[model samples]
Target: MQRKITPYLLVLPLTLFLGIFTYFPILSSLDLSFREWDFMSSDKPFVGLENYALLLSSRDFWNSLNVTAIFALVSVPLRLCLALMISSYLVREGIVSRLLRGALFLPSVTSAVSIAVVFSWVFSTDYGLVNGILAAVGLPRVSWMQDPQLALGVLIAVNTWKQLGYDVVIYIAALQAVPRELYDAAAVDGGRRWHVFRRVTFPLVMPTTYFLLIVSVIEAFQVFTIVDVMTRGGPAGATDVLVNMLFRIGFSLFDVGTGSALAVLLFIFLIVLALVKAHVLGRRVHYEA
Candidate 1:
């Protein structure tokens, strides 16, 4: 009995820490989502699911959800494809490959806020480098930030540029792990480049691809700094994301209950997305020894 109790005592601190630090906060947020209480006010009113209903009925919430969905759908595939292509090229043995890989990965180590600031200047209407180059080639100057449609696209492009490097590194690692013997066997079989990739390389890399897909989706939903720094949810709430909406409600409008409800809803949506992806795509992932 003492031996069993001693092992339990060893893990008790960690269990208690997780309960206090992680589970407690989550439970508290869920509880808060069902109540009406401004952080500054003394009286707390029980609202049940009223906050969730309010957000679901609000046009702004739906609009932000649409914007977030568009951003995720557009950015993730482009970023992953570019990363896979670049990583594939870099994985080939050569002096230039090493140099190029290092260069490509530099952006991943840089601060996002700094990147956003630089991109803002580059996309600036009056004196941005992009406009200057377009003008040099005899083209019209477009307002990237001020235009509602263009603002979200600009943010998407910026995010893709910043994130692609990390994805490239991930793909590169997976590519390196693929056996050279498989490529040799494909060569012996007179396999074309596409055939080799389709039959041997891609199948083995599916696990990494699935992992990146889920993580990219999750990160895309939490995108805030780029929107905050570049457009501030834009000219007409065009770039407003659910997280950004939650921020506006909680910090700007001071609607604590509504904000908590939004957070809960976002959390639920992400969980459902992750579970669906795992259920649907998990079987598709191939693990190689």
Candidate 2:
């Protein structure tokens, strides 16, 4: 009894902290989603799923979700693949490898808002460096942010570039853990570089790939700073993601109930995805240790 009590006592502070902070806020948000509130109102009217109904019926919500899905689908795989390939290549080379690795990893450690600001200028339709280069080459200047079709792609590219560094670091670590003996055996069998990577390295790195995929999905669902700072969900809401839409509903429009509904939906969606990922993939990690 004393041993069990001691363990419970040790965790009491953490339990209390979570109850006050995490659990309370989640419960509050859940309750808030079913009611109507203007953020400063003394009285919150109980609306009973009206906010959720409105969001479900609204075209904006669907559009934002579609944009978010596209952004995540395009950015996550490209970023992870590029990172894995570049990191693996770098770890096999000499002095240039070290220099390039450091350069590539810098963006992940930098501020996202600042990076978005710089990209905003770089991607500007008029007088931007990208358009300037196109003009110099006698190509027509592309309206990057102004065009609805191109805006989401530009935002996806920015997200990929910003997140590439961290993925590279993760891939580098995974590549280093791969044994030299495996490579030697592959070479002795007359295997080319591509063959060795496909047979040995990729299989060994499957666990890391799964991890990056799950994390990228979660991160993609929470994207807001870039959309808010760069495009403001402009060009007819082309780049509006779920989080940005939530902010617009909750804060900008002062409709807490609708915002909370979106938040709850996003939270539940991510939670389900995370659980499925863990249950399905957690059992499949290749361990050589």
- Model 1 root-mean-square deviation: 2.0
After superposing candidate 1, which stretches have Cα over 4 Å from the reference? 1-21
Instruction: Tell me the deviation in Å of residue 206 in model 1.
Output: 0.2
Worst 10 residues of 2 by lDDT: 280-289
Q: Rate the local accuracy (lDDT) of all candidates.
A: 0.92, 0.90
Q: What TM-score does candidate 1 reach?
A: 0.93
- Using all chains and alpha carbons, the TM-scores for the candidates as numbered come to 0.93, 0.92
**Model 2 lDDT tens row, 95-117:** 88888888888988899999999
